[model samples]
Target chain A: MLTKRIIPCLDIKDGRTVKGINFVDLRDAGDPVELAEIYAKSGADELVFLDITATEQKRKTLAEMVRSVAEKVNIPFTVGGGISSIEDVDILLKNGADKVSVNSSAVKRPELINELSAKFGSQCITVAIDAKQVNGEWLVHLVGGKVPTDINLFQWAKEVEERGAGEILFTSMNNDGTKAGFANEALAVLSSELKIPIIASGGAGKIQHFTDVFLKGKADAALAASVFHFKEIEIKDLKEELRRNGVEVRL
Target chain B: MKIVIIDYGAGNIQSIKFAIKRLGFDAVLSSDAQEIKAADRVIFPGVGEAGSAMKMLKSTGLDKVIPELKQPVLGICLGMQLMCRHSEEGDTEGLGIFHADVVKFKTQLKVPQIGWNRIFNLKSELFEGIKEQEFVYLVHSYYVPECAETIASTEYGVEYTTAIQKDNFYGVQFHPEKSSDAGEKILENFLSSPSLLK
Candidate 1:
């Protein structure tokens, strides 16, 4: 059986983890590689490193960080944020990143998705969509949800799958930091409409939220940042709880 | 032992190299037929479309060299699919090492079945210590159906061969490099265990 994955996303900036990580045993909380290893050991099915750096040397820094993390962590990990070209993805994959997620770049030039999936195979290309409801319509947002577009979330996601994306990372801006729960209704729609896997992001506050995202949202995976980083919910306990809830997890 | 990863520019071979490094072994990426043939063990890895990947192998003469190698060759993901007789992906004709055909998943489930999944009915030394129903990571649209050479099987709306073995060749559909501890152990077994070749 394919188990629902529990992913812990770490925000990377200038080759270092930017968010406040509360893992006490971590020798260096800023080290994304060490943090990744901790998550892998603690039963994180996979890891996603979102490079939030905006520097001329961002590519080099992120590549170096990816190489370090790959050398240390055994599980598969995805690298996203600021990845705009085939060269950027090629360098990261050559340095050992398993998958690369494209957000704003794909929206700016949707052909980029076709080119990437064609060159590198759709299995390694993940299209991330950031969206929020506006006037009863789910509009796509850019620049980390700061910029809104006329593109419909459902329409863009359908096109992404048709263009050869292997997975969809749907982050709902309305529920991102609320810690209330996932946008299950929206997610379930994407899951049903698309043939590829859907990863639900934002609004994961508790273990039940994780359970709801899988059971109710129909998400193939659930990605959360602060909850896992701040020790608010341990991955092992969460998996146990999920299994008790009859949700299949890699435990 | 000299381990050479047959790199014909198909997919990410770096992760496999690093996985071996974590297991305390060094692997060199090579497209040369002689270098790959010289190694005690060879890793055949592929991550892209089958037709194109096979074309790359032919361009480098690796397509012919691989099936003739006497060493224990382990094929992973698309590598495993290519070892079979044929593949539905790109309408590809494979290396014919394993008497199986790779076909795309036609179930109502997702196309490319991603994330962790369990492998059971373990029959090879490749899974010597790994338990039945133990989870391993996988990401692919095509799969090899159950066959006589199947060493392990996994379910995803349909039961299929996850691991296959025939003589000196072993193939696993899962990404052992990216599958965490159990995955690392499988790689370690492949590298350290000589019985696998027998």
Candidate 2:
């Protein structure tokens, strides 16, 4: 049986973890690699490193971070943010990232997804859609949710799958940073609509939210940053909770 | 012990290398036929289209060298598929070591059955300490049908061979490097197995 995945995402800025991760064991909250190792120890099925670094020189620092993380972490690792071309994906993959997620760049040139997926297998390419409900319709957003596009979330999702994206990271911008819950309604629709695995991102507040996303939302995976970054929800405890709820998660 | 991972410009080679390194063994990633043949164990790992990968192997003359290898060779993911007799992916011809044909999954379920799946009815020293129905990660659209070479089987939509063994050759459809502790155990089993050591 394919077990439902639980992913922890870390936002990295200037080669350091952006958020003030307050885990007691994790003394250096600034180092992304240390944080990744901690998460893997906690039984995180996968880890996503979002290179929140803005400048060009700092992007190089992100690559260094990836190399460091890849060397120590044994689990599947994904790198995203500022990844636009095949070269960007190449740098990360060469550094041992198993998968690369593209968001803003993929939206600007939808063909970028095809290019990346073709050069690398679709299994290595992840298309992350940052969308928010507007006028009762989910609209794809770009530039870190600063601008909304005319593309419908469902239509873009279908296109990415057609273009050979192995997975879709659908982030509900409205629910982001809200700590309310995932956009289960939209995730449920996407689960039924797409053949590929849908990784539900954003609005993950508590352990029940993870359960809700998996059950009610029908998500193949649920990703959260702050919840896992802080000591609020330990991955080991969360997996135990999910198992108690009858979710087929690897324990 | 020397371990060489055949690199034909495929993805996920680094992770495999790191996985071996983590197991307290040095792994060399190379396309050199001599290094692969001389190594105590070889891991043929790939993640890409079947036809193109096979073409690269032939171009590098690895296709000829790989099948002739005496050391225990472990094929992973697409590497496993290429060891079969044939693959529906691009209608490509494989190395013919497994004596089975790889076919695409046609079902109501997804094409690439991604994530950790359980393997049961285990056989072979490759699964030495691993338990029945223990989870190993898998990410592939094509799979080899159950055959005499099959050492382990997994079901997504249909029963298929997830692990295979034929004399000195072994193959697994899952990415052992990325499958966590259970994955590590499988790698350790392959590395320390008496048959693999000269």
Candidate 3:
């Protein structure tokens, strides 16, 4: 009886939590470790900390932040963004990250997934695909959704699974900030096509969107940034609403 | 009491270290046979393929040392699978502490069953004070079938052995370190259970 997971993603910039986190405890939420503790207390099944910093010094800062979060938080958490080599994965996992999500680097070298899965099992690797619909066809985008590749979403997802990736985190660039709803149709296609779990990301606006992603999109987990960051949708209330809607969420 | 987590180039050892620290015990991560044998409690955790892991253990002489240990030894995930007689994964032979076989799930269900699932049929000191049907985090492709050595079982595609006990040795297919409060309690019981201490 594996239950669907609800994950709140925190973006890190210059070693601090980005995206003005507007919550009851504003002061404590400034620190990534403190915000992670808050989410762990609120019943977040898992957390994703994306280090959006681009500088080398800041990357070192992100590692320190990960270590601090690992000491305080007990639940499984993932660290992503700017992770290119096996060394990066080693540092993060050694710092207590359950899984590492790779988007741009994985797209560039498909064999990195194989190397990672062979060295540290597939369960430790998560391939995050950022896709944008171009003239009715989803194309894989890289460099934080600025550069687009000719790779098709479905075909690339299947390839990722074949390459021994444990899970796929599919983010829809079209619906990301729009927040009207998730890309349920594309998500359903991904769920049906792959044996590995699919995590729907980007456009999660309301509580209904969470339910829709699980029920309609058939996603195994739903990850959001601003909605949970800004406190527009509380994880506690959203999980309650999900359980009421007949989804098997951890209470 | 000193806790030693066996490190044979496996994944997620840090989380286990953190969990032990939270329980107010200092855990030492080591692959040295002397350190592992000297510890009061030894935790054997794995999150990789069985064949390669066993090869590392054999090369480092940990395979021989683990079974000879009289102290309480707990195997987690691939660690539990490696304690069995055999595994379908890589057709690899296990350490043979528990008389069981790890086989691949041959059902229509998903290959890698991931997430928190309830474990019932508790009958071991490892589950003391833990309620039946309490959820624990598990992420594995293969499972140990129910056998005489089984101490706790769970229903997924079918009823399978999620926990096992044989004298001083214990094994669990779930990740107790990552399983929130219920999981922490199991760790505490393993550290404090009187029967295990004896």
Q: Report, to 2 decimal places, the DockQ of model 1.
A: 0.92
Residue-by-residue lDDT tens digits, candidate 1, B28-102: 999998998899889999998999999998888888999998989999999999999999988999999999999
| Model 2 DockQ (Cα-based) | 0.76
Computed on alpha carbons, the lDDT of every model, listed in order, comes to 0.94, 0.89, 0.90
**Of the true interface contacts, what fraction does each candidate have?**
0.89, 0.65, 0.60
Q: Choose 2 or 3, whichever is better by DockQ.
A: 2
lDDT (10s digit) by residue, model 3, range A1-251: 77899899998998788878888775776699889888888888889988889786965787788888888887888889978889899888888888999989999999999998888888889999999999999999998899999999999999999999989999999989888889999999999989888989988889999999999999998999888888899888998999999998877
Off by over 4 Å in 1: none
Q: Chain B in candidate 2 has what TM-score?
A: 0.98
Best lDDT goes to which candidate? Answer: 1
For model 1, residues A23-53, the per-residue Cα lDDT tens digits are 8999999999889988999999999999999
Docking class of 2: medium
The TM-scores of all predictions, comma-separated, are 0.99, 0.98, 0.97
Per-prediction count of colliding residue pairs?
0, 0, 0
What's the C-alpha lDDT at position A215 in model 3?
95
| DockQ of each model vs. true complex | 0.92, 0.76, 0.72
